[model samples]
Target: MNKKNVTKEKKTRNVIIIKTNRKKRNPTRTYETVSSNHYEMTVAGEAMHVTIERRKGIVNSSLRLSTKGLLVRVPLDLTEKEVQDLFKNYKDWIQSKWQDLLEKKKRQKNNKGMIYYRGKPYQIKVLIEDTIEDKKERIHIDEEAQQLHLQLQSTEKSQWREILKEELRKKGKEAILQRIPELNKGYDYDYNKVTIKDQKTRWGSCSGRKNLNFSWRLILMPPTVMDYVIVHELCHLGEMNHSPMFWYRVSVMMPQYERYRQILREEGTYMARIIDEVELLE
Candidate 1:
């Protein structure tokens, strides 16, 4: 290749796009589906649409609920009537779970000051310190109490929101730094920098320079889901694209990765909305 072509190839190889962050929020059950079998079901007196999908590797039928609608994934051999029968068998259980989801949405809508850490929500309490003699600021995280107390001096003028944001960044960076090494063990994954950014749309990204970059928002997810993102970017160090070979390597490192992947696909947008006050999404 000529010098210009060589540089272009080099750029193409190294300039990988950031990992996709699905931030589309769908509070209602309206969604576009190609499946002609789409139909509506009433659970908890709320109408939601349902769609059935068949895949080759699926051995048993599975069901999940999301804002878009209910999805039933079944093995290729499973007929539509069989799926209906499965739902019939689990009717009561499905209604209970769907009711719980609606209740959670009610809480989220009314929540004023809350933060999510490691897949759990903690209430954020900003208060003027009543106990400090010198009037210093401190953050007391009561995990057991499920609260973050931001005690600021009477004269302190910093935005408590910024303070809390910085605190989250520190915690996120610490967690990512700590977990990467633990997950990287037993593997020959090679990479350069591990940057934690306030990425609005991506859980993680890997560059052609072999640098690994992750969003601090990932700290909001469950640890297993966070680890999946880590292993995903690390896998790119060996294979640069989302080819089958790359997934095989990721599977070798984290066998249950797909379970977390599904969680991300379903709840990622909701998670992104959690502490969205300071960093508003467009």
Candidate 2:
């Protein structure tokens, strides 16, 4: 075995130990499509689009299963036989991931507008109020009743989405800031600035400059899930990659990290779709 493959092999083994993680997969898929950087292939009765990226260094071939497709990264130095063996060994894992993603897609579709919050089947009503109490100048959420009320003075039909998004951004920032100190208890990781952003794919990220960025979508997840993402990124202040040490830091800070991690892996994609289907009322 090449020294390059050994490096990735070690990482892969550790991933197995962590055992609960990211992305959606499609196993029994066969799409006959071609792109300059990708091609279609079938593995274990499942068809997929695969893209290969070769890199220099102690190059170990690895597979990444995403909602888009599979990516195969390999060492530039590998022989034809080595490359072949890599896929032969990885095929089962790919199929398993594909099935999981397919199921997630189904669940995502079923959830459309089923739960009310600024989206269609438009179940929540707008409660118009006059000279309201100390509620938000614009909107108030009645969580138990799942309603959005508009201060009669605050109705700018074009801005409903913006108003709601800004409120979450403000509240999301305060919520994250409050959790950070308690979660940061002993880690004492030096960090600057916590920002809530509107992001498409990621739940949270830690910057190279030591700032933290969280997706506003996190506001929609369970409170515990939000905390898991916070610790996941905050730990990055000390360890950046998802290496063994990175996961260890996370586990130490939040012992239930694995459970939360699994929850996000299974349901994160669905949550995003719910937010995407919003049809603001006119």
Candidate 3:
């Protein structure tokens, strides 16, 4: 999730990668165009010289033909005419997708960052207290309220933050380990290491040797959901490819896996976004 968040004043550009597959009836297929600026347009390999703009929310989205394909950027809340005009302007370069681009937009719209942890919306707040849970312990989180109360047990604030991070890592790792035995019940997995990282790309990854790495954000998700992710990765030790056989193995271990996978895909975006955009400093 090494996603760069564009600033308010920054002028962002939308770049799409047009893939031309000679096998198809329409050999050229417009993949997708993404932007921090909200707008929708497709890019074609044939059209690489024109630009168009659409209104998305408060910003105007305009698309132009680029070396990559089509680039669009526009102002906020543009009309249908503006969007169609851009497509018309670059019709040749804007090939249609097999699945409508609108469907992808729908997926994005349905995805939310609002995490339902411990049966409620997580509201993270930070406060300072002198109470000592541990000598160097600096952060105590309320799962219900999603609040992080910082009790600076060390003279150095940086030390306190580091200690807090360590605590989170330790807790998250333990949580994952505790479920390993149950998840791998009849099966045997040489569960090696469980480390917490601010990973940018994936939620969790497992090595051939059964070593597991998970994002600290997994701690923010529901216990069952988090366990599902851990189980899914651990299963990778036995089967690497995401084939039906591999999924069957995962299902045998975690019956509610399908549900969890759906939740993770829909909600993981917001979780990654939180880790990227918000720093809970105590």
Candidate 4:
């Protein structure tokens, strides 16, 4: 028997650090401190928050941007002047990214938008009505009208959004459960378990234990695309990695798998954005 030795690869940390000697500048510049560990600076007329995080493994300084604010990771050995200078050098890049994030947030605030289900666009309709049921129920999908109706007693947008996600997850779970068995028939592989998850970046993952994890957002994709993802993960049951044999197994089940893969590569980010915006409504 030939035994295969597989070594797990460590993922590289995404840390950006500037470690170059800086030219001497005006020493009289004043900086506004937000807290003991945070510094506030005005760049291009926009307020940028700088946070300093000290850690053991990090050898250099790094800058990261998010919706909340900017984070700077620096080694404990560096002086405050060095850190401030580093921030000044990357001020332009920081300002650009901050502006971009603000624009994205503005766009995401408009949650009254269309969502795709099974390759069809449906308008989201929030219906507020008093009902006997304490829990939010009576979710309806009008296929003929191409609208997803969320019947909720609470007029709060956040509450309605959560209810809608729960309803969608339920629907997604049902669809995955119904489809997996049909696809597994006649196949030699015996899957141990199947689970639906509210994943952000991944569509599906297969464990060595024969357990399959699928994203609930699969319901938002076209039927063909969803089938491709299912088959792709199922193929992993036979071959754990994306070898040529794995592709062969996937192609046997889905001949046009490449087409669907291309579609996902192009539009997957947009779909993720839609899901995130809906769930993150304030």
Candidate 1 clashes between residue pairs 3 or more apart in a chain or in different chains: 14-208
| lDDT value for model 1 | 0.69
lDDT tens digits, residues 170-216, model 4?
87888888888888773667898898999856999999999999988
Per-residue lDDT of candidate 3, residues 4-84 (tens digit): 222222211223322211133333543333333333333432323334433233232334432343545554343456455
Q: Report lDDT per candidate.
A: 0.69, 0.63, 0.54, 0.69
List the candidates' TM-scores in order.
0.61, 0.58, 0.53, 0.57
* TM-score-based ranking: 1, 2, 4, 3
User: Candidate 3: lDDT over CA atoms?
Assistant: 0.54
**lDDT, candidate 2, residue 253?**
73
* Whole-structure CA lDDT of model 4: 0.69
Model 4 earns a TM-score of 0.57
As a whole number from 0 to 100, the lDDT of residue 275 in candidate 3 is: 34
The TM-score measured for candidate 3 stands at: 0.53
In model 3, the Cα lDDT at residue 241 comes to: 79
Candidate 4: residue 217 Cα off by (Å): 0.6
